[model samples]
Target: MRSDVRDRIERAVDLMSTRMADEDAPPSLDELAGAAAFSKFHFHRVFRIVTGETCAQALARLRLARGTNALQRRERSVTDAAFLAGYGSSQSFAKALKMQTGKTASELRNEPHILARLVERLAHVEMAGGEAGPRLLAIEIARFDPFEIVAVRTEALYPDVAGTFSALASALGGTQGVTAIIGRAHDDLEGGVDGRPVFDCGFRLRAGDAAVPAGAEAMTVAGGEHLRARHIGSYRALPGTVDIIYRMILGRSDLILADRPTVFHYVDDPGETAEASLRTDIHVPICRIASPKEKESK
Candidate 1:
């Protein structure tokens, strides 16, 4: 990525943080455009190009993500969350919130924690459209280590995984970190048998040496055995590639998937499409599925 473009994106994120901080603030598009060093006419398009959403789309997403987080974990009131997220009134927030989620604000607050998780997961559907690129280079077991990431996560399925990844990358602006899409490609893990095709998709962020920014918290990937593969192709073909990898490797039973697969786009270039040169190293954490004899021995 060009340093100039990278700098502008960081500036845009900074401007967004400032805008969100002011409770009474109604920031103008012109200010955001200036902060991004983009022309007012082009800012909306450019911002969407870089972040996978228009400025308004990103704002709503961030607001909702923050509001949901507050609603579920912080025990904060819906009224407070509404205002904190720049909503004019709880009524307005509740209407939109209920549209996105089946539950009303008060209902959501009283609902079980699982309901909140359901809401969080359902919110990711809008981020999937993005530029398609070429396949990622192959990777091996020695390439990565257990590391930490802080991210704003969602569960919506996107039209394009590459676009979803781009939003994750944008969310990490101003930080020295790699934004990666974490997910399990398919279930069943059996060869030649098309089983259920469900996987977990979320973001993995690595905090850099720089001071951690507000609202970015830390989470860790535990150390364990993993099955690794490097895929080189268009984004659309990844699901099949992942399926193929599982069939070949897991068929041999050298590893069994401990959880979902992690698609690591370690060398993503923000300025270009994946077709220009795509590279994502996928890792599925695994352990030996104990045999009957092993269980008996234990």
Candidate 2:
């Protein structure tokens, strides 16, 4: 990354935070793109790469945050929150509240604890489409601790990881943290997979001595350098988010894509948590830049 890339992105996020805090709506994508001095063509990709959210996600988060706060305020009626949330009516707002928070609007109003997690998650609950979606992305390079994972590899018959993950879970029912779903995809699937794609679907072992689940294989992952970001709320948008990150990395001069596969860490259980409150972290392996030949490749 250029020295100015991070600095400029940080400035853009500061601007976004300020706008979200205002009583009025924020600037459009075009506006933020101009401010960032990043090309409009790559703005969304760059923003999502650095922030792990689309412009739409950012807008929805702010709208929901403001509305949820209104719900908690004694003076603010559900109607007030609805309008504050950019919803046309309380009915719509309430529907969104339940979908996003898994609680009625009344429940959130009466309980403060629930709101805290929502804020922490930065989840979005949009009733309808299209806010110019001028995107909080704090994209960072971080190291994950070394760990061992017991996972099921996708078979010829089972190309998708869904069934593989399920079988692993059933086999590991006795294991702790088996409910947490995590995966690694070796292929980008950019050009399309060769007969079957490569995916290792399962849980990271918490104990070193823990036996690998009957049907799974154990491997040690070094978990070194990776581009990391948090995506709170819903896996529905995950595919697009990952694409955006890939585009940004491909277009960048500083990024050196590592040989290893990308890791998807599913932070929350959608079955147990609301769709809007689901948490997912994407870890894109990155190579450390050093040699002049490597730097000169750009």
- Residue 263, candidate 2: C-alpha displacement in angstroms: 0.9
Alpha-carbon RMSD, candidate 1: 19.0
Worst 10 residues of 2 by lDDT: 126-135
Q: Kindly list the per-residue Cα lDDT of model 1 for residues 7-95, writing each as its tens digit.
A: 67557756665565454353566677678665443344334444545555656655665566667755688888777766788888777
Q: Which candidate number would show the highest TM-score if scored against the true structure?
A: 2
Q: What is the TM-score of each candidate against the true structure?
A: 0.38, 0.48
Q: What is the C-alpha RMSD of each candidate to the true structure, in Å?
A: 19.0, 15.7
Which portions of model 1 miss their true places by more than 4 Å? 1-144, 158-171, 174-217, 260-263, 273-276, 288-298
- Residue pairs with colliding backbones in model 2 are 51-137
Shift in Å, residue 284, candidate 1: 1.7
How would you encode candidate 2's per-residue C-alpha lDDT over 69-165 as one tens digit per residue? Answer: 7766788899988898888999998887788778987777667787766655553322122221222285688888767778877633222455676
